[model samples]
Target: MAACAPDPEPRERGSRSPSASGRTARPGEGLLAQWDADLLEAAGAGDAASVTALLDRGARIEARNEDGRGPLMLAALADRVEAATVLVERGADPDATDDLGDTPWVTCGVTGSVAMMRVIWEAGPDLTVPNRRGGSPLHPASERGHADYVREVLATTGIESVIDRVNYNGWTALLEAVALGDGGEPHQEITAMLLDVGADASLRDRNGRTALDHARARGYGVIEDLLA
Candidate 1:
C-alpha cells in the first residue's frame, strides 16, 4: 500500500493569495517592461549608444511614456539628433503623435532642430498633419519665428502647396508670423521665406484679419510692406 502524503499547512488569516496580490505576468512581460523604461530614459537623455544597446537587447522601439511620447518623439524633444537618427532608422514612425497630437515634425519645429527635421523628413512625416493646438509644423515654426524651420518646410518636396494652410484659429503660416512675431530679424526672415515661397498675403484669420491687416495693426512696418 502506498503511504498518504502529509496535508499542506493552512495559510494564515488575512494572508494574501498570489492571485489576490497581483496578476501573473508572462516571463517576457517583466523583461519588456524594464526595457521600455530603459529605452525611454536613454531616448530622453539622447544617449544613442544606450538606445542602440537597449533596442538590440529586445527593447520595443515604439515604447511610449505616460504622455504618449514614443522614443523617437522623446529624442526629438531632447534634441538628441543621434538618438533620433537611430530610432528613425529602426523604423520608428515619424508621424506618431503624443498626447497633444504633436508629431515628430511639429516637435522638430518646436525644438528648432534642423538636423532632427532632416532625419524625420527622410522618414516621410505627413506635412499637413495638425497638432492638438490646431497648427501644423509650419504654423508653430512661423509662430515661434523659427526661420530655418520655415525654410526647411518650404524646401521639402511636397509641402509647397501647404505654405498657406490655416490652423484652428484660421491663421496661416504668414498670419502666424505676422501675428505672433516680435518684429525682429528672425520673424522678418521667416516672413520673407513664406513670401518667397508664394504664401498668400491675402489670407484671413478666424477674426477676419489678413496677414497684412495684422502686420499693419501691430505696426510692423517691414512685415506690412512684405505683405503689401
Candidate 2:
C-alpha cells in the first residue's frame, strides 16, 4: 500500500485585505503589487472578468495575500468556481498553498464544493500533498462531513491509496470521520462512503483506538453499527 499523507490546521483563513503576501514590502515594489492585490480581491469575490483583466494587465497570477493565499486559493476558499476556472485557464497553480498549507485543491475539500473539486482536479493537483497538520485533502473532507466531495473525488480521482492513509496524528480519514464529526447526516454519509470504498476498518489512531471504538465512545450509534 502507498504511504499515507498528512493534513493542515483546520482554522479558517484569516480575513486579509486584497493583499496577503507575507513577503517583505519592498519600497519600489509596493505599487507593482497592488494590481496583484486587486487580482486577489477579484478572484475571491468571483469577479471572473476582473480576474482576467488583472491578469491581462500583468497582475502576478501567483501573487499572494498577507496570509500567503494566492488568488486561486482565495477563489477556491470562496467556492468561486468561475474565478478559479479563469485563473486555471490563465496558468494559475491550483497547488499553490497558503499559511495553513492549503492549496486551492486542498481548500476545495474544505469547502465541500464538488464543483470546485472538479476544477482543481482537472488542473492536476498533487493528491499526495498534505496540509500543515499533516492531513490529506481526504482527511478534511471526511472530518468536515463533505460527503459529496468525498464520494465524487474518490470516484473521479479513482485514487484509493489515500483511503486508508494516516495523518501526522496517525488518524486515517475513517478515524477522522468518526472522531471529529458530529455524526450528522453528512458525516454519516461520509463514513458510509469511506467504508464502502474499502477504507481500512482495522486502522487505529495514535491512541490505538479503532474507528468503531471512537463511534461508540461518542455515542455515534449509527456509525458504530456501520463499523460493526
Candidate 3:
C-alpha cells in the first residue's frame, strides 16, 4: 500500500530553513528537514532525476513521513522503477520494514510489478521476513492474482517455502488465493503456479477448510479441477 500520510505542505518561498522544533539546527539538520518531504515526494512520483537531485543536496535518503515510510517503500508502493533504482543505487534498504512492517520487497507483491521485483531482488531481500499480517510476499501476490509475480518469485528464486507460509489469519498463500481471489483466469493461473511450485494444498484454514473445499464452495470450476 502507498504511504497513507499525505504529502507535506511546501515551505513558503524565501522562508527560513526548516528545523526540528524546540532545538537548535545541527550542522545538517536544517537541510535534511527542508528536503525530507522532497525526497519521499520525488520517490512516490517516479521522478528519478528529482530523487537523485534531492539526495545530492543533502536530503537523507532514508527520510520518512508520519507513517515511517522511507523513500524506497514509497517508490515500491508506487511501482516507480526509475525512482526506486535511484534509491537502491543510493543505498536505500529494500529489507528495511516501515512502521507497518512492510518492506520494499513486500510491496512488490502487492504492486504486481515484475520490474519492481527485479529491482528489489537485486538488493537481496530477506525472503523470510513477513509483513504485519505474518504473511509472506507470496500471500498478497496470490490473493491479488499476480500470476507474473507468483511465477517469478517461485520459479526463479527457487523459494518453495514462501508458498506454504500461513499468515496470522491461518491463510497460506494457497488458501488466500483460493479464498480471496475472484475465480478468474488470473486467479486460475496463480493457483496453478502455487500448486506447481509445491504449495501444501493439504493445509487447512482457521475454519478447517482446504483450498479445494473453498474452491468447490466458491464454484471455481477450473481451480477445482486443478486442485482435484
- Total colliding residue pairs, candidate 3: 0
Which consecutive 10 residues in model 2 have the weakest lDDT in total?
11-20
lDDT of 3 at 29: 58
C-alpha lDDT of candidate 1 relative to the true structure: 0.83
Q: Judging by lDDT, tell me the better candidate of 1 and 3.
A: 3
State the RMSD for candidate 1: 7.3
List residue ranges in candidate 2 displaced over 4 A: 1-31
The per-model lDDT (C-alpha) reads 0.83, 0.85, 0.87
Q: Which candidate gets the maximum lDDT versus the true structure?
A: 3
Kindly provide the TM-score of model 3 when superposed on the true structure, using C-alpha atoms: 0.86
Single out the weakest 10-residue window by summed lDDT for candidate 3: 22-31
Question: In candidate 1, which residue ranges exceed 4 Å CA deviation?
Answer: 1-27
- What tens digits encode model 1's per-residue C-alpha lDDT throughout 94-186? 989898788877787787888899988888887678776777777778888888877876786467677777777778878888898888888
TM-score of each: 0.86, 0.84, 0.86
User: Which of the predicted structures, 1 or 2, would earn the higher TM-score when compared with the native?
Assistant: 1
Residue 225 of model 2 has an lDDT of 92
Rank all candidate structures by their TM-score, best first, as comma-separated numbers.
3, 1, 2
